[model samples]
Target: MSRKTDPLIVRRLRGEERVLEVGIGDRTGVAARLVDAGIDVRATDVRPVAAPEGVRFRVEDVTAVDEPDAFHRVDTVYALNCPAELHRPIRDLAAAVGATFRFTTLGYEAPSIPVERETLGGGDTPRLTLYTATTRDGTPRGSR
Candidate 1:
C-alpha cells in the first residue's frame, strides 16, 4: 500500500536538515525518499533491519531508550503508523531532546500525544492523519 502521508510528513519537515525516524521496521522507502529530497535522515527500530541505500539504520526502542544523547542528535523525531502505546514515549523523547515529534497512527485509533492533526490524500486512498507534537503551552513544539 502506498503511504499517502509521505508528502505531508516531508512538508512538515521542509526546513529541517536532519530527522530520526523511529520504529523504522523493515521498510526504508520513506527514508530513502526523504534522503533523495536532500534531507538527512536516519532510521531506528527495536530490531535490526535492512535499510535502503544511504539510509543509516540503528537498533533502538522508544519505550526503553537508554542512550543519554539519543534524541539530542536529531532535529526531529517521527514514526509512521506507530502504536498508541508509544505515543507518549515519543513525545517525552522529543521534549527531553528539544526536538520535534511527529507521527501517524493506525486508522481507527486515537493518538496518545497532544497534537495538531492534518488530513492527507483523497478518494479511495485511506485517509491519513499526520500529527505534530504540541507544547504544554498549546503551541507546536517545533514552531520555534
Candidate 2:
C-alpha cells in the first residue's frame, strides 16, 4: 500500500541534521522515504515497532524524556496525533531538541450539527485545526 505519511516527514528535512517522528504507527513508509531522501531520522512512541532502515527507534513517553537538552540536536520533529493539552508540551519538546521545523497533523474535530455560535471572537463556523510550530528555541522553558 502507498503510504501517505511519508510526505509530511520528508518535506522540510533537506538541510537538517536529523528528523524525529513522534508517532510511528504503520507509517514506516515515511521513515523509508526519509532515509531515501538523505535525512537522518528517529522514531519514538509509547509502543515499539521494528523500524525501517535508516530510522532509529526510541521507546519513551514524550512527556517523560529525561534529557530535554537532547532535542537541540535535531532539525525537525513530527507529531501526528493531537494530544489535547499536551500540544504545547510537544512544541516545547521540539524546541528543546533544536528542531528548526515542526509539523503536526491533528484529527479534525467532528462537525457539530447545530454549530454553536459565539457572540464574540467570531460567528459560528466550521473549524479545522492542526498543530505545527517552529522556533529557534530548542528547549522547553516557560511557555510555548
Candidate 3:
C-alpha cells in the first residue's frame, strides 16, 4: 500500500483516536505512517519486532492475553490481513477494553466479528475493503 493510503486506512478504522495495531509482523510501515500523520498508535505481535521511530512496539499474544489492562489505553484495535482464527480473540480483547475492533481479512474471507463494511479509494485509486466491528450496543465505533 502507498504511504498516503496507509494513513487513510488507519483513519477509516480508528478516526482520530489512539489505535492498537495487533498482529503487526516484521513491517511497521502502517504504524509509522499513522505516527507521521500525528495519530497515536502502537504495534504488537506474538513475537518481538522492531518498530519505526515514534511508533511503540510490544509483544502480545491475543489468544492468551490475560492482562486486565491489555488494551485499556487505546480507543481502537485493528490488524491488517488478520488471520481468521485471531478474529474472535481480537474482538474479545476490544470488548474487554471497551475499545472498537477493525480488521482486513485475506481475499474474500469474512471477519469473525460482526462488522460494518467500508470501501476506500475509487476508480484509478486502489480500493481497499475494511470491516469495522461494533460495540455490544450495536454502535459502529469510529463512525462517530
Clashes of each: 0, 8, 0
Per-residue lDDT tens digits for candidate 2, residues 1-144, read: 123433533553555657787767666776677788888878887888888988888886777765765533576676555444445556667656555334443454321111121121113432323234522352322222
- The model with the greatest TM-score is 1
Error of 2 at 55 (Å): 0.7
Candidate topping lDDT: 1
For model 2, which pairs clash? Answer: 71-97, 71-98, 72-97, 72-98, 95-138, 95-139, 96-138, 96-139
TM-score of every candidate relative to the true structure:
0.85, 0.65, 0.84
What are the RMSDs of all candidates, in order? 2.3, 9.1, 2.7
Residue 117 of model 2, lDDT score:
18
Which 10-residue window in model 3 sums to the lowest lDDT?
A: 1-10
Candidate 3 or 1, higher TM-score: 1
Tens-place lDDT digits, model 1, residues 3-116: 555665666676788888898886666787888888888888998898778777778777887553843467888888888999888887777777888888877678886788
How well is each residue in 55-106 modelled by candidate 3, as lDDT tens digits? 7778878888877474446888888888888988888777777777778887
Clashing pairs in 3: none
